[model samples]
Target: MPKIKDKAIIIGVDAVLPALLAQGVSPHFITSIDPQKLTYEKIADSADQIKDVSLIAAPYVTPEVHKIFPASNIFWTFSTKSIESWINSMLEGKILTSGASTCAHLNLTAAIMMGCSPIIYIGQDLAFPEYRDHAAGVVLSDPDQIKKELGVTNQNTVWLDGVSGGKVPSTRGFLSMRNHLEHIMASNPGPHYINATEGGAHIAGTEVLPLQEVIDRYCSETIEFPSRLHTALQDSNLSNTKKLLSGLNKALNDTKSLSKTVNKYDKLIHSILHYIRSENNNGAARSVSDLPILLQNKISNAESLEKKMDNRKHLYIWQILGEGTMEDVKKSECSLHEITILAKQPENFMLSFTKNLERLLSLNKARKNILAMFQHRLLHIINFHRKEKIILKKIEQKKNMEQNLFELAQFYFETGNLVLAQPVLEKLLALNPDSAEVLFYSGAIAARQSKFEESEGYFQKAQEADTAMSKRVLEFRRGLGGIYFDLAGIQEDKIYSNLSRKMLFKGIRYCSNHPKIKQEIIYLAESDLTRIKSALESGTINDVETILTVWHKGLEENKNLAPCITDDQIAGFHRHYGELLLKKGDLDGALKSMQAALKFTPDNPDLYATAAELFFAMQDFTNGITHLNKAVELDRSYAILWENMGDHLLQTGEINDAIAAYEQGFIAIPENINLLKKIGDCYLENGQLEAAREAYKIVKEKYELAQPPRT
Candidate 1:
């Protein structure tokens, strides 16, 4: 490889990128981290227009992006040293250290590895300059929308050194990046670091210079830049392909061993469950005496397998195969650790041990699926390079390959490549026409493509094939209901809407014990209720009793199925149900329902407010005052709660407490015109004429400001 002694520009996609492009700095190479940003039509067009500016990218660039910018070069910055060493051995290149989390760190490492002297940084603006987070011509989210979504305001600002030496607004993310860069520059003493970004947070050890000046000083003469990128690509392809195949073979062997271990654990779980069941009929003391021994044996077997699979080679195999990240591997290990800890607890040993066994079984299943998918992809890669059609034929002819095909199709579906996944599912269906799992995925793909009729047919077929009442079947039922809901939305037909409601009710009846399925059912019910309310308001429909009956039935089924449903959820259901009863003029029924909701969730401020409203409707002013006081005490920041408390206090003849409540309300909502008027009224009623006049003046100014200007 050629050594890069001249200055190189590490182009980050920060807001200052356009500035550097405008300055016409022709560096030897442009090291880009975010390929999606770089491959934006305008940015790519600009880069293509500039000759001899090679684009080097990080390895995490997705396949779609590679298709967009095929000419760009990629370098491996693996997080683990083993993968790095493996890849470097194959490619015969020096392994460069990956910058710890961010792509900017990787870019810096790349520049240092190239032995670039006087490296110039452009578009490294770690802070938002003038509230602009990205450069012109780069597609980004609206800053105002981001602020609103995150519930942030302009007041949440961090200070950074401005372009001209004063402090400017920055974010914590920018400051951390700046600190990392400064530390890197400080540790490496040979190269002179220069920040060419005209506006951004300042680095302590780098000289700040304009891009034009840096270009004039560094690019005084045209020098020949050598080409080694093509050779590097060829070497990487040949060497990495072999290494990937090797890793896949080892992973396949490990997965087989892990599968056997998991099967053994499954048998142990079944034995334990059987013993527990029989112990209920027979004597329990003998079973209880043997429980610890069974638990210890199971735990020991699981721990042995866990240690065997926890080696660096197996742990990093996913990253080496280009299938997952280091973070993903770490997360899997953390989950295992937590499950192990849960199993070790003394109290509730059976429940904890069973939970751990279930989690381990699930993890093993996922690992097996991943291993199969990796094998398929590796074969595809090998065929691509060697120009052979052997693996494809083997996949087609192999018997009992349903699991592998299903996993591969599921992977493609998740990665948003339905085009590739559809044919695989079709083949799986042909092999096993009555497989519920295959039919369900077929329906899901159809639904995603907006072919609701075809999706409905597939879902109905899956439901028929699923005679065992398995979890897959229940989820398919939910999917079928969602399809009907979508069809109703598109056609606005009453028949489809009723079908949607009926199917959702059926699915919830069978799977109300599942937390995820229960949540989905609740979301569907709430959405339908909103639609019903809108129709009633517009005189489009008036059968409120039928809709309420369906909703009540679903909630009742959920309550019967599991005690794990949270108290907060039950309270919310009762509160909404009570409000609906009030709308129907059943005052006594509404009051009872609201009181029951409060019993479940006494600390909930919103529920208290609802109870207050219910009491006030019954002409029980004293009870209403009590609930309103509780509401305000629970949440002082809620302006509406404080306002309601003031209203009730004034009714009870506590004028001083009312004034204090209104004042607190004003503090929570300083710009509320109604709150200001209420405060003024309280002051006027208390004989504070001067205070009332001041409040009225402020309200008047606010009202005038709200009015339109004269033309």
Candidate 2:
């Protein structure tokens, strides 16, 4: 309030506030986003006791919060002009700065405007720490209560940077708040932000320090703030009042014009719906194209009205009444586009036309309610300024009409409601014929409906629309691969299967870096191997060898692929071939293939173990022991490798070596019951009764713990 140029700590998060308060660091100003936080009560009680400390309230503050704090000690910060005008016309026309959409942001902006420099942030953890949603003393509802009240449980966790520099459990909401704060800080660069919250995700551009350290470094001993704040508020009120009244009159006139425009739209929508329902097939098809021309005047009128109402709405009831039906009005333009497309297709013209009519009717119904609400609020504001008590006419029940086509479609898509999303996507596509975003959504919708051909077309179109392949080529190729894989599985015709195979290969060529795409390619190849072999044998697929060669070449050439193809994957290919050869009684060929696999995955413990087994089968004990030892040495953490080494040593009649190997296995996996038992047997055989008892005791303890406690 005193234009403290040195420092001011803005407190928002409840988690860190109590800790800062305990440290005796009085914040310059305390801000509350939600009046319901437990810290608000604490702050209110301490406001009178703390000298020069001001309480800043956001527009969302309840009446109860106002009563708790003295009026003189409270300085209001308006988040937007609409909020300012609605609360007090005296505070209207003030420069309302946005703070990246949070009350913390509002506090930061207020502090900056109040001339507080080098702001210190406390209790702005912006993350759920230690698996706790909020800090101690912060009010939180139970999961069941939240689910009942909000129709969804608030209990969710995400990974955030903990104090220890590792991921800790947090909530998505906190992460979002943290991201917004970071953006705000980035945008406002002059004032240095010192993060004294101490724990939680680290925010860039804020120096981390203890609250006391920050205070000692920047704060002065004593300062007069309350008197300055009071005077400033009075000056602002007087200046804003005059500007607000002028804006209000303009808003009233704009609302009247918008209301008439909405009425016109309503009449036009009704006319179009009636015409569509009454007309026959040929007439309806023609009307679909002609309807846009008929309603062009009304659409243009609505747009002009909206343009005039643009920034003026922010001066009145825009925030309270919501965005109104402007979104629906804008989407009507898209409906007109769809109608034009429908006109060209006479086969489904009437059905599509009727659907568009129904949408238009829905939009109009919503527009009427929105306009009515706006008119009512404007009248109420005018009456308040005039000091008149007038009974206002109440509108009927508000029917929930879909306002934003894109958002609604997105919601349906995310919720797995493909059927609901498809028509909306079609409308979107009509609106922007070349929009890659709409094409991508359309492709997704088709894929979910299992319309593979349609999905393929949409995905290809999306890829083509984004010719630079800067945004969607990878995703499109992956989608195409999935479609072809599905098509290959379902199609019985050899020619179709071959085409699917070729497309899949092409998709793999384009999206070889995507692990899922690579895996899908491998799956299709292996699953359809027999069919492909038959096709090759019958000379139906002449370029089988060429396709396989190109597939391997693509995998090798992918620059984005970062060693995703492991040595084990190479070994797996050889192993599969070896198994096939073994089934054909080709022992020499099988051995050669297995040896080839070992060459690629020399350090792979499992491959070494498999090679040892193969050697044992060939009665080559020397090579078996060599491979087993290599396996154990390569991965000492693997208990199986140690066990294999122990088994080989025991078979060779090396009792001491066998006991050592078993002990090593037990060390690697102490919970391995089999290894534990083997260690005990070896100890017992060596007559070491104490060691035997120790091993058996561990086994018994582990076995008991693994068993469920009495019921």
* Top model number, TM-score: 1
How much lDDT does candidate 1 score? 0.59
Following a full C-alpha superposition, what root-mean-square deviation does model 1 have from the true structure?
21.5
* Per-residue accuracy of model 2 over 133-186 as CA lDDT, tens digit each: 344433221222222223224455566876437765556776787777777778
- The alpha-carbon lDDT assigned to residue 375 of candidate 1 equals 56
Q: Please tell me which predicted candidate would have the highest lDDT against the true structure.
A: 1
Residue 609 of model 2: what lDDT? 67
User: Model 1: clashing residue pairs?
Assistant: 15-135
lDDT of each: 0.59, 0.58
Lowest-lDDT window of 10 residues in candidate 1? 1-10
Going through the candidates in order, what is the number of backbone clashes in each? 1, 0
Clashing pairs in 2: none
Candidate 1 lDDT by residue in tens digits, 1-711: 012233333344322233445655444344444544223322332433344444455554544333322233434454445545555555555455544445576567667777877877766776666455555433232343333323346554578886558876676766787788777777787888888877877778888998888877775553444355456545653444555656545655665554455456556555655655555433323323445566457556656766666556456554454343344456657876776676565554555555555555555556656656655665665445343233345457775488767766776665555546778899999989988877877876665443445766877788788855345645655564443334223333332233344444443333334444455455555565566667567754434444444454455544432233456655655565676777778878777777877878999888777778778778787887678768767886556876877899899888888887687677766777888888889889999999999999999999999999999
